[model samples]
Structures are given as structure tokens and as C-alpha cells.
Target: MAEYRLKTPLSNEDVEKLKSGDIVYLSGTMYTARDAAHKRLVDLILNGEELPFELEGAVIYYVGPTPPKPGEPIGSAGPTTSYRMDPYAPILIEHGLKGMIGKGKRNQDVKDACVKYKAVYFGATGGAAALIAKAIKKAEVIAYPELGPEAVRRIEVEDFPVVVVNDTFGNDLYDEGRKLWEKK
Candidate 1:
């Protein structure tokens, strides 16, 4: 495994260098979206409508953060289970989504999309929401405000931690880990 620090609007080269189980600390801007926002995004794509944000080389985090307390950019920003977004992930990837940050396994179609499109799936530490929030320097809802926490937000992060769960080569960290345990 390798460790890399990457800036957003990731290129094919950026994702190509990664391997499953590699460590990554991402910096720069990324967007937040859960199931609801994902549906809307895919719908816009299918309908040939303009999206709220540019999709090229973008990273999406599957999170619906808690409201900030007294003064903070965001609060308790943990990853949601990835499967919920599987239905729409491939379409997004095909449209130039470069990375995803979430928890748990992804469906085969999503995995295939990553391999075909030079995208990657990243896993954030699920229980470390408070700790993760510290890396988010700024957050603003860019769309779907009525969804509250589910609103799409553009966030700026610095050295935000993640693990490469599925890489462009189609390697899956979760599967590799399971195989290692089976050998034990």
C-alpha cells in the first residue's frame, strides 16, 4: 500500500496511481450528496439538464452532516453506507466523477464503472465523524436546501483522510482483506 496526498478535480493519472488499500489525504473541493441528491443528479443527466455543479473530475462524499454547533464549517460528517447510492453511481462515473468517499461495499456495476472510467472508491473512518469534521475548512449548501442535511454542499478540505477501497484497476480492499482472513 502507498500513501498519497492529492488535490481535488482529480485526473485519471491521480486515480491511476492508487491501489486498493492505499492511504489518501485529499485536499481542495469536493461535493456532498446522499441518496436523494444522487437521484436528482442522475435525473438531470438523463434529462440533459444542467447540473448544479460541474461533474468533470469531481469527488462526491456520501454524507449528510449534522448541523454545526456554535461556530464551525460542519458537524459530525461521517460516511453513509455506500450501497444506497449504487443505483446512480455508474451514471455519475460515466459522466466524469473521479472519486467517491463512503463506507461499505459497492455493487459490481459501480466497481466496473470505476475500472472502466479511472475512478476510485474511498472509505472514510465510519465512527470518526467529529475527528473528520476538523479537516473540512468550509462548507456551503450548493443545492437542494429543502433536504436539510441531505442538501448538496461544496466543501473545502485539507488533508482529509480516506482509504482506497476500490481502485481503477478493479482491486477491492474489502475483498482482499476477506481473502487474507480466510487464509488465516
Candidate 2:
């Protein structure tokens, strides 16, 4: 495929076109959630309740942000490790969650869910909070505001750099990339 770059307001089809390792400049309203929020969401799922937002192909950023300063949309924001959310991932996938942005290795079930559901897992650079927050143009807490940093917020971002660490084809860049470099 040709080198493709996407802007905000991308559709599900637009998200679907993304491949592993494709550089992206994301700009749009992306909802933020993390491990605890995910647990609550999954609980609601078991209770046969509706989610706060339509997740079908919607991008989820795995982050719990620091309190934003006055006049700032959000505080420093960045991807947390994906392993913490492992329990609830498949459920999100089954519900049409097309992608998850986080860091570190995801569980096998998460990888399997990607294959079964055509989802992708992107890894934003770890510890790049200041730069990551810059991509967010706006922020609003959508759920669990009392959770403080773990609050679910709707954030709009632009040109957020990420690499596809895990692709739907069952490839893991963290492992594969390391194997290439760690050769004895």
C-alpha cells in the first residue's frame, strides 16, 4: 500500500485501512479510558447495559491523565501499558472496538481478539507525556470523573505519533523488533 497519513474525523473505514507500522497523524475526538474504567465498562456489559459511547471502530487511548491546569484541555497524557487492561479487552473487541493505543505487550487473548475482530493495537512511545499531551486539542471527562486521573475523557488530538506494535495478522513488533536487534 502507498504511504498513507490520516487526519481527524476519520471513519471506521478510515481506521480499518491502517496497517501495522504505518505512521499516523491523528486528529479527532478520541475517548480516553484505562484499566479501572475498563473494568466498570465490562461490568456494565455483563449487566446488559449500554455503553456511554458507541465504540464501534472508535479509537480508545489507554491513559489516565494528570489534572489539567486552568485553561488547559488536559494535563500530560500518554499511553499506559496494555497488560493492565487484559481482562476487559476481548469484550471491547466483541463490541466493535477497532483499535487500542497503549504500550508494552498485550495478553494473548488481546492478540487473538484482534485476529477474530480485525482490530489493531498501536503503541505510543512510553514516557513521552509532554509531547503526547500536545497532540490533544481538547478534552472533556465523559465518565467516572470521580476517579480522578482514571476518569474517562473525550479528547481531540492531532498528529499523535504511534506505531503499530501489534497487527491483526498476529505480528508483534515489540517482540519481533527486539529479536532482530537482540541477536547474539
The numbered model that scores best in TM-score is 1
Residue 76 miss distance in model 1 (angstroms): 0.8
Clashing pairs in 2: 8-27
Question: What tens-digit string does per-residue lDDT give for candidate 2 at 1-184?
Answer: 2245565444556656766667666667678889889999899888999888778767789998888899988888878988999889999888888778899999899998987787778889888998899989899888998888988888888888888766678878878778878958
Candidate 2 at 131: error in angstroms?
Answer: 0.6
> What TM-score do all the candidates reach, one by one?
0.98, 0.92
Computed on alpha carbons, the lDDT of every model, listed in order, comes to 0.97, 0.81
- The runs of at least 3 residues in candidate 1 whose Cα sits more than 4 Å from the true structure, single-residue gaps closed, are none
Q: Model 1, range 1-184, lDDT digits (tens) per residue?
A: 8999999999999999999999999999999999999999999999999999999999999999999998899999999999999999999999999999999999999999999998999999998999999999999999999999999999999999999999999899999999988953
| Positional deviation of residue 32's Cα in model 1 after best superposition, in angstroms | 0.2
